[model samples]
Target: MLETINRFLQKWMLLIAPSAVILGVTIFSWLSSYSYLVKWVFAFISFVSCLGLNIRSIRKAVMRPFPIIVCLVLLQLIMPSLAYGIANVFFANDPYIIMGFVLAYIIPTGVVSLMWVSTYNGNRALTLTIVLINTLLSPLLVPYLLHFFIGTQVSMDTYGLMIGLFWMIVAPSILGVLVTRFLKEKINKTASFLSPFSKFALIFVILVNGAVVAPYFRSFDGTVILIAVLVFIIACIGFIMGFFTARIFKWEKGVVLSIMYNTGMRNNGAGAALAVAFFPPSAAFPIVTAILFQQFLASIFGRLANYYFHVMRRRIDRRQNGLTGI
Candidate 1:
């Protein structure tokens, strides 16, 4: 049952995760609560998750970042603006609901999604680079995008968000990478243990976000679902647009898949964090929906990359040369 349950959650967004987050947020808001537990838990998970990277990988990525950099630029700037334009067409008059749409629109790439890219053999370095660059630049690009598009009502603290993102996301990743590198001989024996903790923490963060956001659903005026639809549409557009862009560049399958994953997956965790700090409670609904869209399509992309890109194509090429293959 445990294994089966785990599979289901893996397949269904760590099952009940978004639900739990919605529930937690609702309770927190109702009781006037801001749990350090929730924040630290997410921050810790985000930290430990990135603990396996090294400066070597970072530098290598930096040297050869054209494809990834272009994708990151599109994801951080153009796509968010596109989401906003579509959203404005629907959410023009209502400021609070537009808040939800606008908040979800401007946030950049996610780190966790890069894990999915790696697990399924979809250009790990490229995906990791996108996450790193977008995050590091979020201090500037995120605020600029938000200001240019939405203009106000957002608590624009570029420094705070950057510092918070670094502490919560980038710094932890650097530390994690260092630990894995310097202590490889010692930690290698027990590194497998980190997976369970990381998975649990990720689900916990999702649940907390859900719980915190649930309060707004009670009085939601239908705009929440509309914004959710908007997020879905934008995510799908990202997937398709990325594929075409990769085709234009004549990238290999790995590069193409990398772009697809980067474009499609927004950082819902970061989005939620921003929502809580910068906007009203109801402003987080689109971000909440984004968690679902990101997790689901990312999983599907991972599976496809694993089976088709890694396994099947290898088999096809091997047969052409009369050799056995993966």
Candidate 2:
């Protein structure tokens, strides 16, 4: 039974980080309405789960940084505009409504994308490279991306936004890097024991975001449907493209899963915060929902990828053993 659990985790590790947050949030939120303690505890847990990404053997990761850049540029700068341009044709009548749709595109990469990517024994170093660069570049790129593309709805207070972003993205990145550098060898020793609860941390974030959006869902009439459709489209596109891109390059399962997280995950935490800080509450709704939906869908996709990878490995092993007479 214990071996079975270990096998399950190894197969689904990358995907489980986010699941931990989503599921944790659901369980905690239900267990406590008056206890503010639970939320803060889980929030820190969520942050730590993501924080693990910055711990790097950086020297090893820098060898091939090109794919990392391409993904960041494509996702941060190009994708939102693509969504806006496409959604415009469909949502021209209600531009603000469409702005909700564009919210998904304007969002940046998930730092936690690196963490889960690590779970699959993915290109942790590569993911760290992309996430760190994307996060640092986000302040300049995110605002400009919104201004040029969906600037009509999402506004940026340059000083306020930059400063706010620094605390959230930069500060976290630095602290995480520090932790990983100093604590890596130590933490790795206990990683096996602590990994299960890591799922709770990731799942907590998603469920909390979902609960946050649940209230907003009541306020808006058609926002949920529009945001859902647009995000779901990008999620599908990101997942499909990521897999093929990995296959085309003949990347290992880890690299493929890392890219999947990079492509499919959105920096909705940053996006939603900007929406609230810079715009009205209405603008934040879609951004919030986008986070939940992307995580949920990506989790499903991650499972499928894990299953296929395991099955494929067995086939190759059988062939090598001459068991199948290949």
Candidate 3:
């Protein structure tokens, strides 16, 4: 029964996300009271998602440090900068919302990205390494990046943000890794059991966070629509940038797939959590809006990656056959 429910949730996740947002909006008053629980839910999500990570994969991935470095730069520095610029150009009058845009991109790459990477036959080691390293560093990087980019515009509790990220992301991640190390094969069943619970928890988090941003939807006018459009465009750019950057570095298709997913998918759950916990409600709006589009975009990009690599393989095969006079 648990497995059946898990399979159903995983199969229909793309539809579920947006539906949760709508449901939250409809019942905003009831759900908004539970907003404080967002942090706990996110911590649980972080813990369960990290259960599948192999510590040994980190060592293997680090041996090829250049690709990892490239991904980190794209994930942390380049994307946030792009988001900041785009947000400012369009919404200069709305600093909180602009802060929302920056926050959405600067958070670490999503652990859920591992699912996408695995689905596309990506480099699991590389994806795991990137997720672990980026997540561990988020407590530090997120605070500093927020201060550096939008500090003057909005007052933030930097210390609180750090501690929150530590407990919610870093601490839970470490515990999950330890379980994987010690429990070994035993933990696989445990992780599998918890996987569906984690998804349900994520849905709950989205619903509650969506309630926090319900006011925005009530006044869903031109500005709101524009923000949604901009968010979608920026997300598309992340995937495109990751793909070309890998191609430019002459990385293999597997690495390209890993980097593309990592670069493209933000830990929006974490983003929404921080937005609600520390920043104004306006900030959470963009993050919640991102939840609606993220999984759908990932599905589309996965197909695009498949088609892109298939064509490349066909061309290579043709060249080889021509050379052999076949």
Q: Give the per-residue lDDT of model 2 (tens digit) for 1-326.
A: 44456567545644554453345345434532322233343334334444445334555666676677666766775567667876778767655555655666655577657646755567777776766777677767665655676555444466775665666566655665566567777755444444555444434444445444444555555655766677678667777777777777787787788777787787665565555455554565666556656656666777788888999999999888896575
Quantify all predictions' global Cα lDDT against the true fold.
0.67, 0.61, 0.92
What's the ranking of the predictions by lDDT, best on top? 3, 1, 2
Residue-wise C-alpha lDDT for candidate 3, range 136-201, written one tens digit per residue: 999999999999999688788999999999999999999999988889989889998999999999
TM-score of each: 0.81, 0.71, 0.98
Q: Which residue window of length 10 is worst by lDDT in model 1?
A: 27-36
TM-score, candidate 3, is: 0.98
TM-score (C-alpha) between model 1 and the true structure = 0.81
By TM-score: ranked, best first = 3, 1, 2
Off by over 4 Å in 2: 1-56, 93-97, 151-155, 179-216, 219-223, 310-326
The residue-by-residue lDDT of candidate 1 on 165-279, one tens digit each, is 6666666666666787778766643445565565677666666666666766656666666666777888778877876788689788877878887887776776777676656
What are the clash counts of all predictions, listed in order? 17, 14, 0
